[model samples]
Target: MDEKGGAIMLEELAFEIAKAAHAGQTDKAGLDYILHPLQVAAEMTTDEEKAVALLHDIIEDTDMTANELLAQGLPDNVVEAVEALTKKHNQNYAAYLAGVKKNRLATAVKLADLKHNSDLSRLEKITQKDRERAEKYRKAIEYLSK
Candidate 1:
């Protein structure tokens, strides 16, 4: 397949995997969780980046494994980026962000994810916790930006 066709296929598979993985899940704002990935994917400029964006939360949030994603015909780059984006058990958020920063694709997707998550308008009501979380995201963004 041509590169374009290949990218489309990867993106489609990532979308399906992410949707199924997040089935019945809702974000803090009570919106369907898949919307978050879709929003992040929309901001990405390349197909690989879009696929990574779509699947970023799969390993961390769902039972889906990176090997399973790889076995399904997704490219190594996409799987690796998703893996980099996944936060491991007991992993410090700063350390996780540092790992994410090591992968260019993951870094782009994470920045988009953080920006989307930082949007206060997404929440019906803002709280002190929400503000604090947003501040953390801001710092992550700053760190990743550097």
Candidate 2:
């Protein structure tokens, strides 16, 4: 109806999409996968930022495309940020971070994503591989923090 109402609906839609897209998925810690995006979105300040955060992993992990999200009525900026946040299968981590840094919206959401991802406490058991991944996330956080 109004501007604020539209923003709320957008974020709600993002949440619904993310929930469905990640259904039956679990994180490395075996927690429900949707919690990651929910936590990331909670750290965002604006509705659009929250929406982007919620949908950030959709395209990367699911069959959904950016165009599909656009068709669902998400704003272009939100979709663009979500698209930027998606790292291609063949893309290097550093290169992906570089692209993420180029978009302010994606950067903010990514910082939150990295922050959540870096928390080893979320894992049931810490392993070499987990530590290594956290280290990589730490560096990405450092790079994105600048």
User: What ranges in model 2 sit over 4 Å off?
Assistant: 1-8
**What are the TM-scores, per candidate, against the unseen true structure?**
0.93, 0.93
Question: What are the runs in model 1 whose C-alpha is more than 4 Å off?
Answer: 1-8
By summed lDDT, which 10 consecutive residues of candidate 1 come out lowest? Answer: 1-10
**1-146: candidate 2 lDDT, tens digit per residue:** 44765444778889988999999999888989999999999999999999999999999999999999999889999999999999998999889999999999999999999999999998878999989999999999999999
For each candidate, the alpha-carbon lDDT, in order, equals 0.93, 0.92
TM-score of decoy 1: 0.93
Rate residue 6 of model 2 by lDDT. 46
RMSD of 2: 2.4
Residue 41 miss distance in model 1 (angstroms)? 0.4
**Residue-by-residue lDDT tens digits, candidate 1, 2-99:** 47655447788889889999999999989899999999999999989999999999998989999999888899999999999999999999899999
Q: lDDT score, residue 123, model 2?
A: 80
Model 1: which residue pairs collide? Answer: none
Lowest lDDT 10-mer window, candidate 2?
1-10
RMSD of 1: 2.6
